[model samples]
Structures are given as C-alpha cells and as structure tokens.
Target: MDPFEYLEDLEDDRTKRFIESSNAQVEKRLGQKAKEVFPSLVEKLREERPIQLLVLGNTQAILYYGDETSLEISGRRIKMESRDHVIHSLERVWNSQLVRIGVGIRGSDEGYSLLIDPNGEVVGKIEGLVNQFFYQEGKLCYVKEYRREKSPDGVEPPVERIFCGDEMFPFYPGRGEWLSVTAEEKTTALLKGRGWSEATLYVGEWPELREEDSGKISSVHIVRGRVYYLKGNDVMMDGKRLFSSNHPVEDMKVNEKFVVLNVIKDYRSSLSAFTPSGEPLWEYRGEHVYSFDLMGEDVYALETSFTTSHSLLRIRDGKPYPLRVGRREEMEVKDVYVKGDVLLHGFLLTRGKPKGVIVYGYGGFSVPVLPFSSAIFQELVKRGYSVLVTNLRGGSENGEEWHRQGMLRNKLNVFRDFSTFLSLVKSLGGRTVAMGGSNGGLLVGATMNMYPDLVDCGIIGYPVLDMLKFHKFLAGMYWTFEYGNPEGDDRDFLLSYSPYHNLKEGLPPTFVYTGLNDDRVHPMHALKYTAKSRSLGNDVMLLVNLRSGHNASTPESRAEEMAYVMAFIEECVAHSSSSLHTFTIKK
Candidate 1:
C-alpha cells in the first residue's frame, strides 16, 4: 500500500496511527539520551529577554516578560488587548481612549479589524476580512483582502476604502495592501500594486484609484499642509518632482515641514532631509542601515554588525548618538566582514574546532536577518554548535533591488546565495545542517534538493513543500507574484524547485515538522513529505505539536517544539559517533 495515500486523508485514523508509529520509532532510537537532553533544551529556550511591542499610535510600548505583559511606563497591561489571534497592525486615537487593531485569524490569512475603547472593551469589529489600515487623527481608512466571485482568477485582489465613519467596506473588489490614507475632505491613498512592485499616488472614493498624479510613484505621504511622494528616485512635493537621486530612495518619513529620505546604492546608505518646498537641509552617508523608526522626528536607528550584536543609535538633525537601553554584553565574530553582496556572519561557541554546524537562512517573503531576541541561535550556540547566519538576496537586506533580484524567475539567485554561504562554512571544516522555517523552509528545502552535498541534515518547520498545490492554501494566492502562479503556463518553472516534487532518495536525515492547528500551511505538507521520504527508504522524522499555529503561540509550545528538534539532532550526531556535547533532560 502507498503510505503517502493517507495524505489525502488528513487526521484520519490510519494517518494518525502512522504518524504516531513513526514518532515512536524515533523515540526508541533516541532512548535514554533523548530523556537526558530535552529539559536543557527547554530550559535554554525558557530564558526570558526584554520583549517590547510598540504601539506607535500613542507612543506607548508593552513589555512582555515571563507570563505577563506590562505597560512600559506604568507597568500595567491593558486587559482586553490580549487575544488568541496575533496582532498584525495596530493604532490608537490621539486621545488615547480608543484603539484599532488588526488580528490574524485561525485557518486563514484574512483577519479582523476591531475597535477597542479605553474601557477595555471591543466596541466594534469587522471580522475575518480586514488586512491593513491607516489612521490619521481620529479617522480610519483600511484595505481589505476578500474573495470576489466576479474575479476570473478565483482569487479577488485587495482594495482600499474608508470606514464611512463606522467601518470600511470589506468585500470591495480591488488589489494592493501596501497603502496609506490621509484624512482630508477628499481622501487620498498611496497604493502599491502586484506584490508591491509598482506604487501609485491616488485619491478617490468607493472603488477607483485616481492615477492622474501617479507617474511611477514609489511612495506618498501628507505632512502639514503639503504632500510628499517618491517617483522613481526623485522626491516629489505636491505634483512637482523635487529632489532627484542617482540611486534609489529606500525609505521616506515626513512630518510637519520636513521630510527625510533614506537613499542608497550598492549597499551604502545616505539619509537626507528636505524642506516642504524640497530644499535639501542636511545629509549623512555611511554604512548600510538596517532600518529606523521615526519617533516624532527623532530617529531610532537599528544597525546589525557582522558579529551577532545590535547597536541602536538615535539620530537628530543628522547627528547620531548611542542609544542606551537594556543593552548588556556583546558577542564578537572574529572575522567581521562582507564578501560581495552576501553577508557571511559566523559565531563559534565551542573552544576547539566545532563538531556540528548550522547554516541558518530565511530568504523568502523579503524578511531581513536581524541580531535581536534570537532564541534559536542562543539555544544552538549554547549547545556547542558553530552557527553561520547569512543575509542573502531575496530579503530587504540591501532594499528592493536585492529583493527583486531573487524573486520570480530570478529566485535561483536566492538559492545560489545560500549555496555560496554554505560553501564558505564548509571551507571552515564542519558538516552543516541547513535549517529554516516557513518561507525559509522553502529556501533550505530547494537548496538541499538541488545540492544534496551542501548539507548533512535538514530541518523545515511549517514549510510550503508542494508549490504546485500551494495556491490552494491560506493566503497562497497573494504570494503568487513572489513564487509565480503554479497553475499557469509557468507551472514547469515552479516544478523545477518544488521541494516535494524534486526530492531524491538517499538524502540526509531530515526533520520535517508542523502543527495540527497550522492554518497557514496545510498539515498535509509535512505528512506527505515524510511519507514519501520513508517510502524511498530515507532517514526522516515527522514531529507534530498539537494546538499550535504558525510560529507557535506561546513559549511553552516553542520550547516543546525546540526540545524535540534538539533531541533529534543529538540522536543524529550520536549515530554518527561524533558526540561532542551532552545535556540533562528533566523527568
């Protein structure tokens, strides 16, 4: 019988039993050693750090520690803010009495936008449709991603609308999520189209995007009584092009009479300010900036070095100063440098030559690598494994050009970047376990599938393996512009790297895991992948944690998942008979 045939029957008795049996086999093989190491893994993950989530609406931040969340100022958490769904976007009225929040719901990429009063009550809601929103003063405008049956593509794109004093229209037919609305007599919005590649400056009502003033616009903002936007590399105020740059404008921030533009080319960044009329006020050019938050005209610059350490700086009037906040000791990477465009960052925690190595990557969805609150790296490093983290293309490491260079048909560039980083680690003499989760899982999966010699073992969590059936999953349609629509004429292109379809027998011992409650990725991915690997007589394990969503909801759940993977790694090293470290697991 085909073991993978059960994949068509998710949560069925046969499939459940099969998964249980496979897990039990792994347990028996690990035996006492697994019992001895699980706790330390959990304990290491249990260590608390200063976690803060900012509510830019009221300039208030919430600190999450242990099982508690506290207001940074008064040390009291507003009761009704906590929920089962993850907070995606949030804002509060200037009065501080009203709050608006967008939440990611279960089993779908679509979520709800809710309005909460100062009395800690959810007074109003638009459930399971609202994706993002923009607020100015007390007025609210939002963008919705809903299925419109009229769309020939089966997936209706997203559209922006005002709340009409009560709520925004959810079922409106449109496309685009990267948008910002201004609260004027005639509302205006900056709309980004199709994977946010093209931007438009628009002003309209109901369903139309006014494009008269939008000529290859990149971004838009309204400040004071004036309007500011970017068209290509030129900064435009009102309808006239003002400050033009030879390089691309990466980011823009406007407030009152001044606008600050972060422009860059070839991995170097320069920040410059302009008056409302576009007169250049000041400019500073330096090393690549990771990102900066505009805190009332003051800048909190986030910088990441080759070492796994972060330094926050505050910039005012082009002058930068060290920001002292909750910083302790720092870790140094001996050879702190960059080769070509790939950032080769390594940390060796053990004294002698490392026995195990982990090459970490997350190149998809344009998520950048940062050196902050990385529990995964901390746990692995403390376990005596050398780790290499790469800031490859396909991420916003060097901005949009870098992202575009690795997307669509050019996605092979991302895979190539990972191969280059892995080759760098191999020269240092260690067998690497290529690792990633979600989109990163796709990264490691595709690379390992194409170049099996690059890694000894692979770990993929909540991954999208079957790119062919990917669009059928939650919010999968939206990502088509990134990976290409698998059902179209380009289906063959996707088949070239869909990990499940490209898997070969005799690959490394792979750990494929996901959650039962994973609404984002279909649970059948890990199930089917593991089944096929087993059928091909490959060494693979499927780990499932119950009642968890993508990224896992709570710390205990995270620790449980981490302990299982760590235990599996220990077993793999033990079987190879090159055990360099050991840990105790509690009863």
Candidate 2:
C-alpha cells in the first residue's frame, strides 16, 4: 500500500461533504463578485488606453505592453535592449527615458539615461549622469562638470552623487536622490537657500538601503524641502526620531499638511496621520488597511473588510466616511490590479478531510497564473497547453483566514484543491499542465502523488519535497507557520503529504529545476525527489544550474527555463500519454 493511500482511505464521508459545501459557498460568493467587478475593470482599461506599463528594477526597467491577444516586452522598441543575455536592472524612470544605476557583476558602474525615441525606433543611451542630469522647466538638461570613476578592477560603479545647479545631493539606490546639505552649516541655512525658512532637515536611513533590507519603504514625503522617511516602525525627519515602535508599518502616503501612516501589529493594525512635528491628527483601528492614495483635500484609502470584500474610504474634515464608494455588504472586490479584467483569488483548506495540504490559485506569490502577464505562461499558452492554478487554503489571495486554513494539519486540502481544479479544467475540454516553485513546488509534487491521474505533466522548481526534513534546514524553519514544527503532531501530518515518501511505481511525467546556489530551499529537495521518482520507474527530468540562486539572474537564463517548460508541456499535450522515458534531464 502507498503512503498516500492512508489519506485516501481515511477521508471521512461527512468531512468530504462539509468541505464541498464550504467550497460551494466561497465559490458562489467570490464568483459573483468577480463577475460584477471584472466587466467594469475591462472597460476602464479600454478607456484609459494605457499603452505601456513600466516597472523599475534594481538596475533596469521592464516596459510591458498589452494588446487584445497578449502581453509583450517593449524594451526592444525603445532601443534599451542589452546585448548581454541579462538586461540591466532599472533603478528609476524620469522624463521618458528609463534610468539604469547601481553596481553590477562589474564594480562601480556609472548611471546611464536610456530613452526611447518618439518613433520608438531609436534608443538614446547617455552615460555618467550622476550629478549632472537635471529637469529644467520639465526638460532634461545635462551638466558637463560631473566626473566618473572606474574601480581598480576596471568595473564601472553606479553613480552615487549628482550635482543639481550649485548644490550636490546623494542619489538613493532605487528611490530618487536627496538634497546634499552636508556642505551647508545648518538646517536653517540649507532651507534658507531653498527659499524656505522653517524647513526641517528630514533625516533617516536612506530609502535605497531600507528598500534593499526590508523589501519596502513604509512611507516617504517631502515637507518644507526636507524628505521624511518612515521605515518599518521608525519615523524619522532629518535624522530626528519622531516615532518608534515594535509594530510593523505596512503602508503610508503623504497629503498636503500631514503624513498618513498604516501600522500593522500582529493580527490587527491601524491607520493614523501626523504632522511634521510628530503630532497625531487621527487614528482608526482595523483588521487590515492598504491602498493609500491622495485625492484633493481628502485622503482616500482602499479598505478590505474582514470578509475579503473591498470599499473606498474618504477621510475629510477629520471624519471617516464608512461607505464612501460602496456599501460594505454590496462591494466584494477580490483582487485589484492597475490594468486588466481578471481578478485572481486564492483559497486554503483547514477543516476538510484532506487537511494539511495547501492549494494555491493563479497569481499566488511568484508562481503566477500562467499565460496571465507572465512571459513563460504566454509561451506555454501559445503552444496549446491549458494551465490551471489551485488556490488551496494557505495562499495570500483570500486573506488570513484562507491562509491559516491550509496550514499545519490542514495542508492536505492543497492537494485536494489541485485535484479538483485539474478535474474542472479537463471537464472543460482543456488538457492540464500543473506547475509550481519553492513551497508551491512541494504542492505540485504532493498533488501528483495523490491524484496522479489528474495531472498530465508538471514542472516543479526548487521544491520543498521532503517536508519531514524541511525544518532542519536554514530558512525552512521559518515555515513553521505553514507546515508546523517537525517535532509536533504537524510532523505526522506533513509525513502523510511528503512526496519523497509517497512515490510509487507509476506517476505522471514530471520535470524539476533548481539552482546550485539556492540557499533557501536547497538543491537536495530536487535531487532527492528526482532520484526517488527515477527509482520508481517514473519519467522525471531534473535541471540544476551551476551559478544561479533562487531567482533567474539573467534574461537568457529565464528565457531558457521558460523554453524548457514550454517544450515539456507541448510533449505532454501532443503525446496524450504521460510517459517520462522520452524526456531528457540536463545539468
């Protein structure tokens, strides 16, 4: 008997019925909301006619363009394409051209200004703009006096300083630059030069350093010519600590006279506003608060109800309008995007028969809904592969409740959820190809074992296959929230779903990929899983990269990985039979 057979046999009839009923309730509620919100979203995108969406990276910019059929990169049209396989990460975008900065594999690289011509045919590349590039009357101007330095190893470093007229300022790595006032004697002197007498010297750790460390900046605002920084729980203005706490500041934005701060502590969080002098203006406690946007004299915040619904709140004249945009009961927006009609939601299972499994839907973390704004997905979709993502309970899409449901002993729901999704897609006359990465990859493996008949083919990347041994590794210990501690009853639950222990004589075709330098999930997960699958006479292919880590380091490498997955899907769909012996695994 297989290890998974225990779970299949132990599933109680009553528990299965309850799970199905709960799933139906959620689907009815969310599916209705999606129907209402998506049509309006599509109309809005159509009216806005947003031709391009630009995303800034560390040293390069990604320009995304969408049409009726697909999403494509516009980098080539702008002449900002890199000859090297890896594109430079974009730091910021000002005027029309994308700005490239920061040190690369080569040391101390100079910042360059990249511009796509109006015709979209010619790209202009200007090097060494650190202190000399300026916007005069909304036009770009170059200062010739700025100097460039090359490291002893002959690598060009990113520009750190920029000269603005007679004054110089430090350029924050990913954020904008700060005014250089160190050469001036006093804060008043610096403010006086800028034609402001009462300007505060807004000081704190630089925004670039904060983004690199925490992955986000809580808040940034310019007041009286000084830039204030609110990072995590600390609020600082010109090196002065205005507020410090143990809480996590999730999001923030500035209005004319005050800076609004949203702080999250544990399960509950709140939103508040303060003056430049650290005086509190207003505060409200809530389960979750986000999407801080400023409009006129009133501050608008996009609020999410505890029930996974959404509404717009307007704060004006010190009063909060509870239903500014729509009634809480009537408004149910699951996922919001800048553009597009599809609103992705996730679910996790907690009380179901197959407890302890995680099912994630489309657009959970980095796994993404294939063919939905993902380059790899589009390529696969073009090849006639139907992709489906299961939002088992434990993903972020449906909020905290859904996530907690799929965690611990409830994790088996993830596998069950995937099985249901695959069955649904196949019923719709579409061949299914399942894919996942990291913890999600663990999900795909577990699903393949329990419902091998459902999944035709799978691509597992850097998966956590052996959940029993996962906590013994480095960052894997932190996953106690999802899988529970190995020493506890959760270990027994995890062992039930551990793909390494559950592999049997026959399984669907599968491909695994991992990086040698992956310090997070470790390469052993992929290696050991592949070895086990091969031992069971299953067709499993593994690809291990020598130099990459958790992320795809270069554009070419990303393209290659996508190509491999696409080819595998083509084979699975074309051949009809899910056989592994026909595929090859390369290192």
Candidate 3:
C-alpha cells in the first residue's frame, strides 16, 4: 500500500466536482457583482469626501495630496523641518488628544539621535547612537546602540547586553540579571533582582537546519522558575538536558503543572508534555500538529490538512474532542486564537460572485489577521466594501500539506480557490478588489494576468513578478520549498503562471508598489511589470517609495501608503463614462 493512497482515495468525485463548479461560479459572479457594487462604493467615496495626504520626509519635508503638492504648513496642514544635517530618518505621528511627532535624525559628527514633541514643538532630545525608540507608559524609551570592533570578516562582533528599565547595560556584571547577546556568549551569572533569580535559567545556541529558520533563537520559555531554550535539537532546561535528538523542537509552552513541547521531524510533528522534574506527562503523534495555544487547563491542538482539513481539537480530561464553531461546508476555519468564547477565528469561505467581495490571501509564513490586512480591510469595509479572506492552499493554515498544495506545480490551486471565493461573493451581491503582498503579491499578479476579468481592481505590493529570474537574487534562493527549484521540471509550471511572462493586452487596472531599499523582493519586479503593462496598453500605476523596505515599517510612511491606496481605489470604483488615462512607464 502506498503512503499517499489514502489522500488519493479521499479526493473523491464530490470534492473534484465541487471545485470545478466553484471555479465557474466565481467567473460569472465576479463579472456581475463588480459591475453592480463598484458604483455604490465609488459614490460613497465621492459623497463622504475625505482629504488624502501623502507625507514623505527625507532631506526635505514633502507633502503630496492628489495633484496639489506643498511644503509649507498652513491652517489645517502640519509641517516639521529637521534641524540636523542628517536626512529625516524616521517619522511617526501619534494622533491622540494632541498629535505627537517622533523623529530620528542622524548627524555626521553627533551620530544618531531622536527628538520628540507635540505638533512639532521640541519636547526632548536624546543624544546617542540609537536605531529606534518607542513611547512606553508616558515616557519615551530608546533602543540604545553600542559600537563594537568588527570581526576579521568585517562582521560586527557580538557583545553581552542587559535591559534594566530604560537603561541598557552593555556589560552588566550583576547576578541573575543578564542576557546572552552573542551566539558564543553564555550567561556567566544570574543576578539577584525582581522575580526568581535562583531558578535554573539555561541559555545556548540553536543551529537551524532548514532554510526557513530565522537563524534566531529556536525556542524560549520559562517553566515555573526555570528557563528552557532549544539549542539545535537539544532542550536545555535550567542547564540540564531534557530532550536531545536530531529532530527539532519547533514550539514549547509551559504552565505551573507541565511543559508542552511540539517536536518536528520532516513532515510529522508530535506533542509531548512533561513535569519540571523531567517526568513524562503525555505524548501524541500526528501530521502537522504544529501550532497550539493554551486556554486555562485545556490545550487547543490544530491539525494540518492531511486526512482532515484544518481541524481544531480540544485536549481536556486527557482526551481530544473535535471542536466545531461553524459548518465545514459553509466555511473552513483555518485558525482559531481564543480569548475566551470570542475566538479570533480566521477562515475561508466560497460563495457565488455578485457580492463585490474582495478575496484576500496572505504572503510569507502565513500570519492571519495581520495588522496591515486588518487595518486596510476595516477601512475598506467602513467605506462600503464587503471583504473575504481566502486561507488559500499555500499558506500555513492547513500545516505543511496545505502549504505544499499551493506551491510549485500545484500553486495554481490557490488562484482557483480565490476565484471560487470571489464567485461565491458575487452570487451574494459583492465585488472584489484582490490584494496581496510579497509572495502573495505574486499570487495576485498571476491571478490578474490569468483571470483578467475576475477582479475589478488588483493591488500587488512588492510582488515577485518574474518567477524565471527570482532565484537570481539573494533572498530568492530561500523560496525553493514554496516555489520549487525553477531549474527542475517545476520551471515549466512556473513559466506557465509567472505574472511577468503572462502579461497580455487586456486586464483590470492594476496598482503596483515597492520600495527602493527592499532587500527582500527587488524593486525591479515592479519596474519591469510597469513597463510591460504600459507596452501592452493596460492601465497601471507604479508607486515606488524612494526609501523604505518591503512594507513601510514606519507609521507615517505606512499611513501615507494606505492613504494612496484608498485614493486609488476611490478613483477606480467611481462610475464614469470616460476612461482614465494610462500612466506612462518611467524608464
């Protein structure tokens, strides 16, 4: 008997036919729904008019609003000019009772310093080489920087550091109050301070074998008074070996009674709980039992899609019960983060298209209800847009298999699933504005190129456009698991769907944005797409941030980007007899 025969048998005629019917429904629904709801959304934008502003600060303060660009601050406008010779490095405006602006300025002679105030009025200036700062409790705390001699290879050598209140001690000798700052650095002493200082605290290095490993600490959790860290495949709790194996301990959680660890080896993951004294509590083996969150005495275990779709199981009274919040037919719950009965349930639903619903999927390692996605969708919904999130095949919702289904040759399933979702939305009277970023941006771009009439408007952010050329870059090599090695037979499938290769004469108006400093997806993706779209006479706009990376990390820049997106959507959805002029490709 083959190992995958079970999966093949489960893919019955019912499932296959359902998927096919869903795809057809999506196409018909999207066309009708987009025509219906677009006018209403556009009218709402026109009537409930709000001023859109783009604030970009570098060497000079720049404010761009529609066609009106200005530098001066007048009655309703706000402005601040940097006094330091350095470029305006960071800017954040906290709108509360009073608008607070925090700015970081770097000077050639003085190094980097931060200034904060209300309405541009100087509140206080902190002088030191600092990378960033945050407002905590009512005071500002700076992330202090320290200079260190470079290694022989020019890498900055690591130094031990400690954070005690607002001050950062680079070499604090205090007992029970030390943090290992370097890979080789060990906690020499446990400084006596707050909490339990005499508790067994262990620290060690964790060498990640997989490409996806962030190269940071593998695991960190404090059980009782003891701290346990996973270094490579070994679990060191209070400087004692608790579990040592070649298989990695993916995740761990602790409570007063027991410590639960999720161990991963290849495709399978097992959950085990143990006492603080190393006594085994319980162990269970399953495929993709990766993520778990505890609520009181019960632990919720989410199984990855294998024989079952992503299912939530409650482990209580030493037994597992399948928890049902909603019907699997109507909606598939991808993830559930419980804060009491009000579960922050992440889900995917397929409905017929006529409902003008924007179907959204995620990018990277798949984090649902992300700050960006939530905020943007909330604003859109407030402006009269129905939205749906598609926990598409490639994401982490169903564990490794779910993720694998949407990668390489099978990657088209994600787009098909999204299309089905849109159709379902349209059947219920909704239109869609498909949006995604980074790898998900590739998903959006490919969808728009392949299914030109499926979406009314597409937002592709820092997208990986050229699949054929993606692996030529630095970070692109890490995507082999998700995208497959392009040099292999998978290259044929990638070429078939690569957005850069599939761009044609007719498509919906597409908006592309990226950053010049994007170390992740090179800006050339946006640049080349813009050129091709223009060459094909498609209406497209490319907004390139002069200085930023991936998603704009700073608050002000992100706000400005969001404002731009809102304005663009408003214009696109507006009912007009005249077609908008296509933007010229900037060489």
Candidate 4:
C-alpha cells in the first residue's frame, strides 16, 4: 500500500467518520476505568509545584506557577514588585495559556512588544513563532515563522519573516540565527544560516536594512562598537582577529559590556566572556538549569541543577548574584548515571518491584530535558510504575556532537540507543510500555516498528511517522535539514527508517494520541497511522482532544491528557504484568 494514501483524505467526511468511530470505541473501552484511576491521580499531581519568574525589571516580574492555584496555562500568578505591600492576584483571561510565546520588555514596561499590559491583557497580536526579537529606536524587530495566508487549509509550512513595527520582510533563516541590535543602536546584524552550519552575515543600518556583507562569515554578533563573527577558531571583531578559542564558537551572546561565547568541544561546554576589544574576562564551565537571557545592559542567568535548585541570578559587575529565588519540590531522585558507548544518560525511579516499567525518552531536535521537569516522572513513580528516563544521542545532553550524532544519516543511532535502553528495561521484567510526545513520539513509534517486542504498549503523540510526506505538512520543511529531506537525495535514508512504511501486522497494543488543533505536527499523522494500523488488524486506539495544539495548553486539558495516559498505562499493566519476569542487566 502507498504510505501516503491517507494524505488527501484527511479532511474528507469518511476520515471524520473513521476518527469519530475510533474515539467512541476507545472511550467505551477506557472511560470507566479512566474515571476510576484519574481523580486520585489528579489529586496526587496537585502536590507537585513549579513556579517561574520572568524578569521585567529589578524587582518587577511575571510570576507564573504550576500547582493547584495554577491549574491552567502556566498559571500566571501576579506578584507585585514592591518591598512593603504585597498584592497577589491573577487575571482570569479565559484563553490565557502561554507556552513558547516570548514577551519582550522595554524600559519601564510602558507597553510590551505584543502589547501585553501590566494587568495581563493581550492588547495586540502577532502571527508566528517569535524566534528572535530586539527592541531599539522606538521599534521592535522580530524573526518568526508564519504562514503567509490565513485560511482553513492554510497549512503552507511557515517561512521565516522579519517584522519591524508596520514593515515586514521575508528572510531565509537557520536554527541558531537571531536578530541583534548594536550597543550604540546603529546597525542590526542578521545571521542567516542553514542548520547552523553555513551562516551568511548581513549587517544593515536599523530599519533601512541596506545590508552589505561579504556573506562568508558564519555567525554575526554585534557588541559595543564592533560586529564579531566566527571564522575558523579566531573571533573576528570588525575585520580583525581579536582572540582565538580552543574549539569552534558554538553560541554567541552579546551585551554592552561583555561578549559571551559558548565553546562546545567534543560534548563538553564552557562559556567564555570577552570585552569588545577582545580581552579575556571570565570563563565558566558548569551545569545549569536554563540559558542566560539578555535584558538591556544586564545578562541574567537562571541556575537550576540537581543540586542548587532554581534561582535567577544577575550578572552585575562581572559577578552573578540572586535576583529572584525559586523553590524545589520535596521529591528525591536516587541512582542516576551515564550508559552506552555513546554516554547515554538516564535515571531510574523505582518503588518496590514495579508492576510495569515505563520507558520514556526524547532523542531528537538537539533539545535536552533538564532536572527542573521531574514532577511528571515523580508522579509516574508514585503510581507503582518504575519510570526509566533515558537521554539518548539526538539531544544536546552532551552538547552539539551528541545532537549531530543523532541527526540526518545517523538518525538510526538514536533509535538504536533507545531500543537498547528498552532491551535493558525488558530484561528487568514487568509489562514494559514506552511513552513519547512530538519528536519523542517519532522515536517511540520507530522503535516499536523496528523492535516490536521491546515494548508491549506504545503511547505515541503528535509524531512524524510518514517520513516521505512529512515535509509537506506544517513547519516540516524547516526541519528537513534535521530529519533529512524525503524529496531530495536523502529520500532513501528517510524511507529506510520511516515508521509508517515499515509497520507490520502484529503490532503491539498502541494508544495513538493527537490534538486536533495541533498545527505543528499535523493530527493527520496519528489519524492515518492509526487507520493503517487498525486495517492491519493491530490492537490500536486513537485518542484525541480538540482544544489543544501541539500539546494540551490549559490545566484542565493537561489533566485530561494525564488521565488518558494513566488509564492506558494501567490497562497495559493489568493485561501484561501477569506474565513478567526478572532478569539481570545486559552488559
């Protein structure tokens, strides 16, 4: 059968009928059981709390919370930025869930770039994923990916565009490329690169955008009175080699006083700071929670590790001190280590002899999960399921080298690494189930196809399965460099590991999930894959929620999502745990 058979029929009435029937069957089977398990599970989830403070000023900030009080969006709990009087309140904006949207704060927070008032009102709106933003000369410039047209079938795969005030321009942009303004607020440096490999420098004067450059420079960073670019090993400051690093300049951050460059060598990372004239200032090599953010003249860093917890520290006078504090939950994680020849890292959360083993991992997109998000894993442990979280090759856990090792032609290594982890888990006995969402979902789906016995139940969400046609879908072309272009020379490679093309008749009990409003990965992926799986007489269930996009945004939606996951996990454990056994770890 053609793997792309269901592509055109996604919006057909027959497809809708099929999805409705699938939803009905799945609900009939698990609705009662879900009700029995989820209420208490939801209660237990309320115990875990996560709080975030987005700095707007020295004292003023946005306090978003995750707990009972913050049951929806990211829980925008407003705290007054004052030393004496304390006013804690939140604006009950019905659709007020904030996810990846970034808010840029100008001086005194007169009005935000998105026109979000201090009282939490989204007065103005913009279209697209705000990638890089800079505010200067009474104008805000941002680079984002947005579809040109606005229509029902407007899934045109967003192209990168630059929006400055009322004027806008389209520019081809790479992953790490960003928009930056010079310290003197004269020139704007735009870095255009593809997959962070080949960058063309474009330096123009403000909104005029009359960029004149040789186009050979890989990265462009404006600091103080000069513009710096990465050429070989030495840092080029205004056509002059100022300093050299031991390795390639992986990332660059600029401020008025300091130009910080991240050196990533063979999976290790270090941050080095330099003056505009290129005098070495300070170097730092340590594990931290999140990346540093630049606000006006200050570069603030948020420190959160398995040890120090979470706190926002300001880089003032060349030193970092606490600006705002964060709290860590009460749960503890024991027994963590690196594994495999590739140094794949993971931790196990075991409670007695676990009835079911949950293997969770995401090894794609160069993205790495930090210790700050162990709440869900902790909850999974509380439910008597031994949660094994693996950090595989595709992520930046070990820096850019690890990410490269899992991209394009080497993508199979990610699956192999994950499958190896699953093998190790299977040897531990108990009914094993694997969970992953988005690119992680692609990992689990591919693993299940290549090694079905590795997992008894597969929970795949908003995944890319039909690799041949994925690029035609929403924002898929943007990742062709990472996933390999199926329509190009990489076609054979993509087809080799494409999950949808390799599915067998005797698949495992699969619970395929998707959000109807998911404009990112396209819900048709889950729908068509589930349809194909069921046609082959595989035990498959399609679960979908209409209100979510990419993921469940609201607290209620997230709770429903958790309930479905718990229900599926419980069902799998009950049916398969009766036949589990213990075995020694494979060396």
The clash count for each model shown is 5, 46, 30, 0
TM-scores for every candidate against the unseen true structure: 0.78, 0.46, 0.48, 0.76
Tens digit per residue, CA lDDT, model 2, 1-587: 43322211114564344334433443343344333333333332222111112232211223221221111234333322432211233222233343332211111123454444323332445554332232433444332212224322332321134334444334322111122221111111111011111122333332222111121132444445455555435676655567754454655655457776766542344677777566887776654554544555566555543233344466675567864332122111122111111222332111212101112342222121211123443223233332233435555334334444566766776566666666544544444567788877887888888988777677798788887777655345545545766778777777888988888878878878776546556566776677668778998776655445563244334444455555555555666532221111111
Q: Per-residue CA lDDT of candidate 1, range 200-243, in tens? A: 56655434446646544655665443567777567777678777
Order of models, best lDDT first: 4, 1, 3, 2
| Top candidate when judged by TM-score against the true structure | 1
Cα error, candidate 4, residue 317 (Å) = 9.5
Model 3 C-alpha lDDT versus the unseen true structure:
0.48
Error at 484, model 2, angstroms = 1.6
Q: Which consecutive 10 residues in model 1 have the weakest lDDT in total? A: 578-587
Residue 115, model 4: lDDT of 32
Instruction: Specify the poorest-scoring 10-residue window by lDDT in model 3.
Output: 190-199
* Each model's lDDT: 0.61, 0.46, 0.48, 0.61
Q: How many residue-pair clashes does candidate 3 contain?
A: 30
- Write down the TM-score for model 4: 0.76
Give the local distance difference test score of model 2.
Answer: 0.46
TM-score, ranked from best to worst: 1, 4, 3, 2
- Tell me which residue pairs clash in candidate 1: 36-585, 158-174, 158-175, 163-167, 163-168
